[model samples]
Target: MARSARLAAQGLAIGLVVGLLTLLVWRVANGNGKGVAQALADGEHPTAPAFDLSRLDGRGRFDLASLRGKKPIVLDFWASWCVPCIHESRRLEAARKEYGNRVAFIGVDTKDFSGDAREWQKKHGITYPSVHDGSGSVLTKWGGLPIPRIFFVARSGKVVGELIVEEDLPRYLREIAAS
Candidate 1:
């Protein structure tokens, strides 16, 4: 009986490990094979993945493709529960003052309740329009998890870069704004 129990424990452990590995493989093999962040890191200027989602402000659905070639975009990925998002989002709000006419500042509220997200926007004084990404599917295409992943897209719909430092916000904004 003791030997049988040991064998069963080992089997279960192996099964768990296999399951986790399979999950990781599936995630990497799926539509997120090379996420925007990875592509940017590889020095590839990939076209922005399109997504149409309902705006949190009840302004109806916003199709990202609609803005292609017409304007540059500052895409901010955030969540209501993420504390750091507050600071980053507020910084964006401040930046909007100077670039509001030249660039579109859009937010993706990922993996959070729309109601809470709306309240967060109002509380934080974030006036930029945002879309609800409750399923995080759009976030996955860009970069998953670790909220506040900001990306800059040129007027041609090509992703320029992702924010890695505070200075990057202004630098990418200038680059994309000129595109």
Candidate 2:
């Protein structure tokens, strides 16, 4: 009985160690586990990175540099395969309508097929322009991971906030517009 109990304890200990190691590996692989929340918490509101990409609809090119000093800009990083983005899409369209010309809403469709992204936007009735980030260069530039990451930028081109939850976006948009 004593030997059996010792063996059981050893097995448990090994399992625990393996579990911890797996978690650590997963976290490190996924943006170092410092997502949008951590970026905001760091209190370093960096300048919004400038990018130029083809429009998702293939209409024309979308340039971030042109938006500087124009108005508050909301950059939403999303992918069609991402479930959360489907829900967030509705909120974004609503916010865009609510704000109505006071802010510029841009969607960055990252790591997704252009046709799929375009279809997704069409299904969601997204009127705001979206750019295809097929290479994920824009995502890396903004240090964003995980779909549905929203970055709020002031008129001065400085990032004001980073949000993952959709509910908080409207309030942030209202405040940014008012300011």
The number of the candidate with the highest TM-score is 1
* lDDT score for candidate 2 against the true structure: 0.82
Residue pairs that clash (backbone atoms under 3 angstroms), model 1: none
Q: After superposition on all CA atoms, what RMSD does each candidate show versus the true structure? A: 6.3, 9.2
In order, the Cα lDDT scores of the candidates are 0.95, 0.82
TM per candidate: 0.84, 0.75
Q: For residues 13-51, could you state the per-residue lDDT of candidate 2 as single tens digits?
A: 999999999998887788434443456679876777789
Least accurate stretch of 10 residues (summed lDDT) in model 2?
Answer: 31-40
In angstroms, the error of model 1 at 8 is 35
